[model samples]
Target: MPELPEGKVTQGIAIATAAAFFLLWIAGWLDVASLKGGFIPARVSGLVQVPGAVPVWLTPLSATLVHAGLLHIGFNLLMFVFVGRFVESVIGGGASLILYIVGAYAAALLHWSMDPTSTVPMVGASGAISATFGAYALFFGRDRTRGIGPLSGYAVRVLWLASAWIFVQALIGMAALGGVQVAIFAHIGGFVAGLALARPLLLWRYRKA
Candidate 1:
């Protein structure tokens, strides 16, 4: 067996979170935890109330740690292992964690705003991982993009990529929603948040250096 960024804090978080998810599933507690921890737009928007030890308001944040199923967690963790490792390596662990957390909240807020009265609970790390993708794009998009800084060149490419990603996500969400819940808005929100934060993180890293 080989190690994949084994010592990094951001990577550790992803592994630990995935482990916890698996453990919960093995213990038959995943469903119970998800119901209690998953973010529900109606509850978040005050359109409905849920009684629990953990406040409904906190579900948005808590929901990021839960996943709908094995495949869901697997895909999210794979992305986290690859993209998250890169983002964390570039921005440092603390900034990476901040981006993930902020992205989660942003995603939840957007999802709530879009479907304020819906009672469905949203769960998974896709939104947070999407944020990492956004950050990765901003950091590396310039190389792939032709031209220079802001407004033209790499910026245009980034914008196009982001738009295409969102569009695809929207389509997937529409197609999957009837069978399985897909928080498309959450992914968009998180990616936008990551894109927005990427520059600031870079600047901060530079200043620190």
Candidate 2:
């Protein structure tokens, strides 16, 4: 495992993001912020008017910084600290940031495709964190397949793990939606983006090194 200090840029971003979410909640601006910053498929698709001054195109990025509640932010930040730090340590902060942003956009695009007319706002860092998990799995999953059947190679193992993860996410999404809506497609999109980007980033990192 890569050892990242507390003050690493990627870690700082994760902490700062969590702090921002808490601050918004404390200030009673979470609702307003979500309204303006959360990713809304209808807004992106131009089927609905944006409520605030922020541009619709920017919501996908901004939405990543917002969270629905304490549990949402807590889980995201925990994953960010654990998975993101390692990814950043391996690939460097720039690549980590790029992965996060790209993952968020990818998540938004997938969610929009799945439900373009939905009025509910989508907000969370799960997609970005899922991207980190994808990269992590690509880098470290082969050795960790303890119970799973033997795989042909690293790629196949990673695919198996990803498939299992997606299945779990689907189950979680169904349960979450039963109480409060969750964007399961966003998680899938982010994980896919991370999986797609990880090898290239690793190659680039190696070349640069």
Per-candidate TM-score against the hidden true structure: 0.87, 0.88
Error of 1 at 126 (Å): 0.7
Query: Model 2, 1-209: lDDT tens per residue?
Result: 44654528677778778888988999999888888889888887788886453698888888988888888888788778887877877787878888988988988888899989988889988887788889887876647543445545655666776797789898998788436577888998899899989988878878956
lDDT of 1 at 161: 70
lDDT string for model 1 (1-209, tens) is: 32445428667778777887888888988777777888888776677766662588677677877887878888788877887877877888888888888888888888888979988788988887788889987776545656655477756766777797799898988798437768888999999899889889877878956
Candidate 1 backbone clash number: 0
Q: Output the worst ten-in-a-row residue range by lDDT, candidate 2.
A: 144-153
Question: Model 1 compared with the native: what TM-score?
Answer: 0.87
**Residue pairs clashing, model 1:** none
